[model samples]
Target: MPSKIPDVVAPGTLARGEQPVIPVPGDLVIRPWVLADAGAVYKAFQDPLLQRWHARVADSESEARGWIEEWRASWADEHNAYWAIAAAGSDEVVGRIALKSVVLADGQAEVAYWTMPEARRRGVASRALTALAGWAFDEVGLHRLELTHSTANEASCRVALRNGFATEGTKRSAGPHEDGWHDMHLHARIKGDGPTALV
Candidate 1:
């Protein structure tokens, strides 16, 4: 039997066009990842904070290249969308952001991001997240976006809150870190929640 409600975003919406480069405030842009960004990606994963929070590390530039290729392929698969946060006129990757675990039928995805050590304290993550959220809601027509982070990650919580993703609740021992399991905070924003601060 068919369900009463239809898909919030129909299939083929993402595949209909190439992923776009979204511009944000502070002269940064959220653009698709490319092979040339491998070195920066490899280096970013080496940061102690990033490795601890994300629970993964790029062992080499080759591994980073493979990761980039996978991100590109996911665009075609419509399962995920990843972008590099960089300056307007340069390819240097100052950060990374993505819409992961996309469920087109439900019009929802989980947002994730990490900034390079050199870019911390400069609003890079929050600014890029605002831009990506705008594109996800306005351009992709997603109905909701959600994000999760270890409750200990106060910086991530700030970024999510700053971007309009309201804190929903905490899930105990939901995330694994270098230290051990961590309580995770769940945050979400719906399409009707209105524009985020920098959107």
Candidate 2:
């Protein structure tokens, strides 16, 4: 075990400090979730499309609050990082984004996101992803960031591409949705990949 490279990102890199609010283009800020956002979280899960792909719905505001608590705990544990995508100076959540399954030693993590119905088609996903990717690469020293979405989700594919995450390949039945297991399109971006912008 000693004959290996050191951790690309130090262990305390994230857990040692509070998750900072990240400002993205389009007047949106990615910030930590609060209990007050429970209603919005519940409503988001009720969206048919969200439920279709994510395969779970918040049964009550209390459950949504629990989800928020879990998100906060994830940051403390340094296993995952989640943020609420909201308008600047507003608490209303327009979307959500996260660096999932973070592996500090490997300098890699999976990205996941979703936008509210009102926030769709407004570049929220792309802009938020760009900001998150920047933070992961520049601030956290992560080397590789992966994005995977159902092959059938054209919108998500476009978001990935717009953020400079190149199409790596497809994973057969890699994601479970309300409909069933679905093939997934895997996209990835590595550090020094060059500027990330809307394509």
Give me the candidate number with maximum TM-score. 2
> What local distance difference test score does each model get?
0.90, 0.91
Error of 1 at 102 (Å): 0.5
Q: After superposition, how far is residue 89 of candidate 2 from its true place, in Å?
A: 2.6
lDDT by residue (tens digit), candidate 2, 1-199:
4837788988888999999999898788999999899999999999989887897779999999999999989998888999999999666799999999999888999999999999999898988998999999998899999999999999999899888899999999889887789999999999988535663
Please state the error at residue 155 of candidate 1 in Å: 0.4
Candidate 1 local lDDT, 156-182, one digit each (tens)? 998888888999999999998889999
Clashes of each: 0, 0
Residue 122, candidate 2: Cα error in Å is 0.5
What is the Cα-based TM-score of model 1?
Answer: 0.96
Which residue runs does candidate 2 get wrong by more than 4 Å?
none
Candidate 2 TM-score over all chains jointly: 0.96
